[model samples]
Target: MLDLVKLSGQIPGLTQHLHQESKASQERLRRALQVFGRLQQEPQVWQSRHVDWGSHLSFTCASPAEPLENSRPKIEPLKGRHTVVATDGSQIVPNHHEIAYCSLINVGRVVLHYGTQQWPLLDSLPVLLYPSVELQQNSGLDAEEVLALRRAQAEVEELAQLALSVPRRRTTLALVDGSLIPWGLEPLSGQEQRLWLNPLLAALERLRAARIPLVGYISVSRSSETVNYLRLGLCPFLSCECYRYCNSDQAPPCQTFAPLPDRVFWGSLLQPGERSPIWRSGAKVLNPFGEHHIHCCYLNVSEGSVGEAEIARLEFPAWVAADEELLKRALAGVLSQVQKGFGYPVALAEAHHLAVVRGGDRQRFFALIEQELIRAGLRNVAVSPKEAQKRGGIA
Candidate 1:
């Protein structure tokens, strides 16, 4: 359906614009790198810098878990028998055009045992949700968002259950596809939080009690957590009042440095297999997380040349970040999986494969629903005209 000939004419101009943008970006990166180097050299200045964090509006940054100038730790080659348990989820949100007001969640679980003779465990758990009181709860989130929240909850709960199933003596690391913090529950009311947030927190608590470290892996993260923190270090004023002082048409002094992502600087600093220091996440959603506070570190999973370094953000709970041994095991397991999977975690990839629901599967799902509805003695059961037309298609 795309017109290649029409798009081809604009390619030259687009390419030129991209090249110019890239050049400018590279220059800005250089400036950011310089600022980072200076901060790294003057550890005292970075340590002593004062900024009234409360003065800012909706500000979030990375809280340093260790000294800013701490050495980049290289991931040790995973030794001895270990297990990496990963889970990912896929969902089908309720369609208004369909008769049933229902949603489905399928979570794929993978337990890969390395340096052992035991076979890997792979499975998927699918749950069907009908119209229920939980669904009707006023959570501010729409049907799609509610589905996502439920899916995330399902993934972590599955991960916890699987991790607990592993022998307590064995070293096990739990990884989910994204953030451990339940950001989706932030907008929910107290009742909704009890519905969603409490279950997630309980799952996290189970992992904590069992001493299994839970990690969230994000590839090529665009998060500016650390960059925002460093911006505070660069503030020239003793006190900042953005609205009163710096609110103007011209860019502020601190704005001179290009707002590059935290990954780019970390990728350049960390060698292949090295990880940056742990930084606490300042996301407001984490305020209610209590002992299960999320922290992050950048892992350079690239096995190629320095220029090809792949930076991945690994987020874990406060307990894992606090314990050196647990953190090491978590990092080692992730790096081993990435190397085996070719720059991506093998367990997660397999889990995703097992979790994905294809278009044919979706069509079949609705068909099953319709069959059940019909068997229930409902008359004139049919899809909306929009849905029927979509299925009919045009010649």
Candidate 2:
């Protein structure tokens, strides 16, 4: 009967589909409830390998660089600067006097552009607000985080509108702070994860179709592919060990594949799978407490300040590490360079919300980007924060 009713909406009831839908709710809801119960035995992991303590990329200023006193490789401004959009997002948590209210915070917004970085001013930095309206909010996140995300999105929307309102600069790149795809998209069959990744996946397909050349910066992502391999061992259903099912959704009537595109799945070998090494130029190995070793991706995100004597690059959380001090420093470094470079740096933090580091995996380091501009196929797929050590972008 329900199928009959749905079929009616698809056919003759086209104009009154709403009426048909309302009439069929009870029956459909009943079936959906039964399906949910049947599915309860499924393993539940509140965590998809991606969940972990968020870290920051930090830096301390050295000294300001001398103004370009004379002629020194002054390439003409990026010709017809199309758009080099680099986005980043920071979640503001609610920690107060009495209780650090257990509230999650999120700020998912993207920044817009229309100018060269050499002279980034209010007029140059534009924002893109409403275009993201259809995205599903991760209300699953802490309530405060959801609110913060909405607030931040609203702010950027206003900024984009305002930027469009006035005279503009030659905008080109759109720097999204996070991943090329949204958080929960891949591993599409996972219960909780899908709720997040679905919309993000849609947005990514749209952008990719547009050929926007989007860069997904996963400063501190645990390769979901690797994490799953480590945790569940094989395809949740088949449990095969032959490196198959690389792209199947979690709870599924799954299929198998081999050697999926690097863009489609993160390198599983470096950590568990064959990880990509696009950031080799900026990699650095760290003995954080001077003994226990860790490899990380260090990008000279910005020349916070420079002198012939010293160069300061803001570093941010690139991996899930054990030390709090290290994480704090990294986060501080990335944010510090804003005043010296351009006001848009913080704006750079808004565009990316999900942290999927696929397609030439990279950490957020503007300097690293500058370094890899020449290498063949410089971009990597699912770069690990550990790769920071491999990157030559050492402090």
Output the number of the TM-score-best candidate.
Answer: 1
For candidate 1, write residues 372-392 as lDDT tens digits. Answer: 989999997888899889878
TM-score, prediction 2: 0.28
* Model 2: ten consecutive residues of lowest lDDT: 53-62
Weakest 10 consecutive residues, lDDT, candidate 1? 50-59
Tell me the whole-model lDDT of each prediction, alpha carbons only.
0.82, 0.31
Runs in model 1 lying further than 4 Å from the true structure: 41-51, 54-57, 189-195, 241-252
Tell me each candidate's TM-score. 0.93, 0.28
Clashes of 1: 0
